[model samples]
Target: MPSSVTWGLLLLAGLCCLAPATLDEDAIQSASHKFMLNLADTAFSLYHQLVGPSNTTNIFFSPVSIATAFAMLSLGAEGTTRTELLEGLHLYWKEVPEAAIYTGLLNLLHTINEPDSEPWLITGNILFANLSVKFKDEFLKYVWELRHSDVFCLRFRDAKARSKVNDFIEMKIQEQDLDLFEEFDKDTTLVLVDYIVFEGLLEVKFEAETYVSEAFHVDKKTMKRIFMFRRSGQFELLHDEALSSWVLLQHYRGLGPTFLILPDAGKMQHLEAEVSQEHLTRIFHSMAARSASVYLPKVYISGTYDLKATLGGMGITKVFNDGAELSGISEGQPLKLSKALHEARLIIDEIVMDRSGARPSGKHRSNLLTVKFNRPFLVILMDKNFNIPLFLGKMVKPW
Candidate 1:
């Protein structure tokens, strides 16, 4: 039985939300690749800001989706309005041409979201606009070309409009718990909504017989009984000296690799502080295979973020302020982003699929190192192709 574990799950959904291929400036060439770098930059920054220095709330959301959705807005943004939005998203610092950023976003979306690929990660963008305003035909056309989304013109306060929006989201993600829109403001001319739902189904999952419903240590004194799934095999392992944590790498079927970092006792804060792109890449390259037993607590995380405050902290302000510039969306009226809402959830448990031969139930050997996530740890998840963070959070309790 393990005690008090504070874990952070950094899931970077590759709806193009994963980190870029490399953080090294020398490795960057085209703007398309730079798009990924920018995504990683924003992803890490946003996750850090949301979690703060001393906060440990389980946070989950997509940075790629946010950056891409706002990139669309940047198309219509003029002057400082556009500058602030791009800077906040970490999309402007590279001096990459604005058009190239849009192209990179479109390319990343297509790269991860091929028509023939499995739908492990599903995402969408929908614009709810006041019926009175008319978006220019060109803007709508480009949105379709860039975002693969459609716009709906309806009254902001209309209950039916909210229901329709929610209904569409539920249909896309197949999760009933998320699609909830209570009321739209009367002055709400445009509401950009983004949602992503990912269920990681690893190629190899722990069998039912091995699962133990045991008491877990949430802290020094609190104990809670939870289903701790156990597996034994050759897992890629890394002992990061700088962070004082052991990094475990696991693979998802069609998604990407997940890095679970178990910090030394009383080292969770130090690990959070030392998190960076360099450490991530170093771990990916340095982790080596080793025989060990791994224990994972079944986890489910969900949260909603007000992008206004989050992006504001990231240096993206004008769009949400009074003197905003969003006329590009619709010259039909003065447009400023009134609300940028996003939500996401992740569930990790035994997802049993049909198997052929005998499962890899390791032989009881004396040398087998046992790694129980019975204490505080961190989970860094990124989509396979995109290499960005899918879901990010710290959970003392996963419900």
Candidate 2:
């Protein structure tokens, strides 16, 4: 179909960097680590935007996916547009120059996606341009050099285009639940689709048989029943006085701890206001190993965001407007980002991840050190080594 929209640069933002060759390995690693930290902070801020004071909304997203996607788009952006984009990503404040951030992101992504890395986690981007629009060879070359991925310019003849794309994603995710067709509009000429699949393996398993129906608090008065998975073992636990929330760290074999924060009754607002990067870092450092019987719901939560407004809020408005300078993408045509869509799905399964890594917790042992995520809770999946959040989630009710 003929459309005004054209091609897009939807590569992972940090997948490649416009880097100078003078830096040593140490410098690159340091820059990448700092970039990840800043990205984590952006994750928290974006989460806060989706979820307000109530903390009653369920949200799941790959902050890295969103950050890198924008980074890719920034390659084509110029003038104030590029500046605003970097600022939104907190790419400016990290002491490292913007080049370093991109360079570091390249290393960071490469390290995490090494061949030895487990299959449970996957993230990739595909930039699709309809056959009619001509993209710059230099742009594609730069993208290929950086992302090490191919961009396809296909003939969008029918719905099959959507089906083909969805099939690729489903195969990668190993699940067919999400439908990406709904996310795209007919006017979209150039599209960049990003996805993340994370199947977290628990270092210690919660027996599936122990799962029992329990009350999950949606609010003070509203409650719902959920098949809560029960386990009792040594876990890193903490009580944050600042947020008045009981923070529990459940370690996933190699993925790191999924921080489950359950706010005290009517304390959700306070938790939202007080939560920050420093606070979370301090909390992680202070957490001590304690034996407790923990309960968590099997949650299937997904978040779909139209990020134009969100990015605009962060001073990235010029790229979406008419005066956008995307000549870096296409020479003769003026490219405008008609839509910026992000979709993330997170499933906290009740069943043990795999046969080898985990064993069922035989039965629930009665103990004073007990914690139940029966209320609205926050789930932050982070990489302990990099201090980066892989998936940030809030489960108001798990079904």
Candidate 3:
């Protein structure tokens, strides 16, 4: 565990070395083959916690079935036959659609909290980076083949059609816009990149250029509510001083909240506005404290370039120093910083999967009958220690 900045720097260094080999078009296919193998290995370990060592025979069945069932089992699904049979089914399906292999696997495994028991030391040096680059290129080739060519796409697309009934059930979350979800439901089988979870909160960050800029243009207030599920379940009114605009909103769970490192007041001019380092330190301390409460609850985390415990149970763990000194805050400002931090925590608590909903957050829906596949026997997770993007990319259930 390191500071977010520390991990960012490490990942950057790793990327620089890996860039060259991946850039070459010829090397991609081989890279993907290797990447998938590694991904499967990691996924297996992750599901071990969710579906015990003795039970994990196949990567897609038993464990997946359990997780998809929302941690409970129906009468017929209780015995070893049901578990092992499901495991065998997943193993059969594992080799068919290759591009989806990595992402699907990761989501399945992560849902089970696979730990990195066998930590692979990723030396971000030239040689190691080049090796990763080679695999990354191959992985990209497999991904492209599935996405672009109609032949593979059509066959898998139908196979996926058979799979979506279960896929949709796993991805359905609370507070989701029913209208939008309904519209997409008919076609909600796995796509190249349908979002499942957004780290820990209701926020989503699409890949660069994934959608046209014009495709999304909500006001700041709405934008905040839309992505601040972990921060606040309720909506808010925000004033966009920069554009002299105002708007209304709604938020979701598991997405990170909006944190303003520096405030921007475009229109209303203030002569000398500043938050001294002392105040900043106090704010940081408050956050750190909330993060360290005795009752460690699940919270969503934002930002792209950091290594969270790739696999483990949910809770907060401090990294780096126990404490640091504060420098510039005036006496009154300390109390103000404390208040801000508390507000932020309260906002976050509101959106976590709690008893606030009539239906329990992580449990399956029973009132409305729906078809679900033999519990995904095992989850297939990706190993992105060498390539960070692959890890993050595969973390969600993408349909």
Candidate 4:
């Protein structure tokens, strides 16, 4: 009943389990491989059900899940088989509504390798450089500015007011890239809107003013003020109460089309983890326009443990403060659950290393582990590299 003894027993069981795995032709059909197969089936099934078959909405799907799934399939299938499975997934990708998802999947596919009767480890580099050309072309553009303008308006009859108007026009021009936008004159009665872009088809709007929130500043006791100025340094009017403050600009630049002002690249990083429906819209729009790479990294680990006792003969202690329940189990529920728990622990601890390319593009990778637990539970998301969380609950709940 000591924890150390339990760990020793678990380690013995794991070694025994691994001993029978040979590289023979029938190796894949062994009982040890069932968990991986089930993982693949369940993961793809969940994705299919939740995401449907639309390329448009595909980018919104979790990048972690997509990359991990391919990595898992790569481990189990060979050259032709791997190609078939990858192509099969591509077939499904075509139905994705979100183009970024399509591109991102392609990025994921480039990370996997076919089994060669030896361990298949993917290096996570995308070989198809040309595959991104179209996406890139769609993102950047060139255009001619037919005319330029500046705000000559006056407020409170002060130089600062006049200066503010100038700053506004400059920021707007860069933010919106309008063919025609400027302040009329120093005596003009009109006030300028901060930063915004509006075309017949595309429109991006930002707050007229920035907030000086105590929480937002490094010095909580003080506030920070951010003013929207045109690229030319002209000032715009103020907006202090807006919830969202970033937008995009689109137009034609001579023979090629161009994207005007983009959301701050820093702000864009926040969008990567957002799973809302609206987040998908922005993600695809950016993907189509800029062809930016969204880098995602997933880590997992492996080890064996004994449920009843550790290798040092100490009794197993509950990992958390909450009391554990171990009433009745039909078979080896504790051992199986323990394995799942160990792998889960490895993932949460970031024990695995990320092996994607040097470029920060949305490249992702994962590690797999065979483990046994000192508790009872079911293994979820292992097939998908357990990138996504298995349960949904409070932000911080009982582990």
Candidate of highest TM-score: 1
Candidate 2 stretches with Cα past 4 Å from truth are: 1-29, 52-56, 93-95, 148-150, 154-174, 183-187, 350-367
Error of 3 at 47 (Å): 34
CA lDDT of every candidate:
0.69, 0.69, 0.23, 0.23
Q: Score candidate 4 by TM-score against the native.
A: 0.18
**Which candidate, 3 or 4, would have the higher TM-score against the true structure?**
3
Model 1 lDDT per residue over 212-306, tens place:
67766656676678777766667788678998988888777666778788888778878878887678887898778987777777767766787
- Determine which window of 10 residues in candidate 2 has minimal summed lDDT: 1-10
- What lDDT tens digits, residue by residue, belong to model 3 across residues 1-399? 332222223332443444453332223334434443443323233333323332212212122222222111111122332233223223213443222222333343343233442222111100001111122232223222222111112222244433432343233322222221122222221121111222222343211111111111122222211121122222233323332322122122321122222122232112012222233223323342111001111232211111123111212111101211111111111110000000000112332333334431323323222211111111111222321112211101101
- A best-first ranking of the candidates according to their TM-score comes to 1, 2, 3, 4
Better of 1 and 3 by lDDT: 1
What is candidate 2's lDDT per residue for 43-112, written digit by digit as tens? 8777777674454667888887788777776776777777787788777665674555666566666655
TM-scores of the models, in the order given? 0.83, 0.83, 0.19, 0.18
Better of 2 and 4 by TM-score: 2
Candidate 4 ranges with C-alpha deviation above 4 Å: 1-278, 286-334, 339-399
After TM-score superposition, the amount by which residue 312's alpha carbon in candidate 4 deviates from its true location, in angstroms, is 30
